[model samples]
Target: MHPALIPEKHPMCGKYMEALVQCRKDNRFSRYIGACNDITYDLSLCLVKEKKIARADRQAQWHDQWRKKKEEDEARMLALKEQAAMSKSESPKEVSSEMQQL
Candidate 1:
């Protein structure tokens, strides 16, 4: 058997190596390099890349949500201002003119 296929003193090494080979075959060189350097291949640089991608996705989602909330808040404030202006108007004619200006 290939040295890479051999189990370390434990049964889990075989499974781990198989996964590592697959990672290499998949062109995930960062993971392969990590596996090559680490004894158990459990703490690889691939994980860092994965985490970075996940974090970026989360940040993008948060930014989108924040933008939507900001738009909603602006809309709410505008509505409140309009309502207040209408309420403060001295006459119905003034209210119509103000609404048209808006």
Candidate 2:
């Protein structure tokens, strides 16, 4: 495979992949006899590491979204409570005026 093509498919393990590909090309006959085993192993390790990093990034993003949503909900609840309190405080005065008018 072309070096450019390998990077496009495995961005994180591109170098390792390309090295293995080159090794195989250099030892075409021995490659089938394990000449490129070390490079293959290294490529697998790189893929695993990249996958772990991706998972951690996704989790962090989800946590941030959850925190923002919780903050918004708390703010909304506080505003509603303040509105309820204001209405409660004003209702008695209006009731007293109505009683006096009667």
Candidate 3:
């Protein structure tokens, strides 16, 4: 899930569902398996209800090229910073060498 999506208020639903599934698989008895299946179905319905709660993405990305452009821009900015730092360090050495030549 995207970071922007609101976290579930009841996070234990998935765990509960998993446990129900496992119990149903291990138990051959009809009553227990039927009970697990019913509970799982109810949990599924409740989880589905969350989709109806309207929410907006905090970090919006409407365009198709947005991700690619963002990545490229970050990479370019980093490269530029590195290049500038390298040039700054090399300049002092070059200046000293020129002074020696004179």
Candidate 4:
């Protein structure tokens, strides 16, 4: 997107970046550059499944989508944990803090 991404959340990006760098170091930069479509396609498929959108329109949208997806997922997980805690006679806050550590 902006040549910056949270690698931990985008495993495909990290994988692609590693391959791109290796290609460049191996004097195959032109090959990777020429395969931009393949890169976008691969990333798009992965990101789409994560409820994110990555396209040529703009980079900020991609970042926003990713951030939104991440927050939604975390909230859903917290809600589930709270529900489980409620059934187990445990504190929601304590369960929530434990979920954060994970």
Identify the candidate with maximal TM-score. 2
Prediction 1 TM-score vs. true: 0.44
Clashing pairs in 4: none
TM-score to native of every candidate shown: 0.44, 0.53, 0.37, 0.32
RMSD of each: 12.2, 4.8, 10.7, 19.3
Q: Write the per-residue lDDT of candidate 1 for residues 10-78, one digit (tens) a residue.
A: 353456666656666665566545544443345344444545777999999999999999999999999
**Best candidate, lDDT:** 2
Q: Which stretches of candidate 4 lie over 4 Å from their true place?
A: 1-57, 90-102
For model 2, where is the 10-residue window of minimal lDDT?
1-10
Residue 42, model 3, lDDT: 61
2 or 4: which has the higher lDDT? 2
What are the per-residue Cα lDDT tens digits for candidate 4 across 1-86? 42444557776567765554555466555664564556546655666654444354467777889999999999999999999878
lDDT of 3 by residue, 1-102 (tens): 112212255463655555665676777687453756666666666566544332224234335368889999999999999999999999999999999999
Report the Cα lDDT for candidate 1. 0.64
lDDT for position 2 in model 3: 14
Candidate 2 at residue 23, lDDT? 98
lDDT of each residue in 1-102, candidate 2, tens digit only = 223436777788988888987997899899988898898888878888877988999999999999999999999999999999999999999999999999
Query: Which runs of model 1 end up more than 4 angstroms from their true locations?
Result: 1-44, 91-102
Per-prediction count of colliding residue pairs? Answer: 0, 0, 0, 0
Worst-scoring 10-residue span by lDDT in model 4:
49-58
Please report, in order, the local distance difference test score of every candidate based on alpha carbons.
0.64, 0.86, 0.63, 0.66
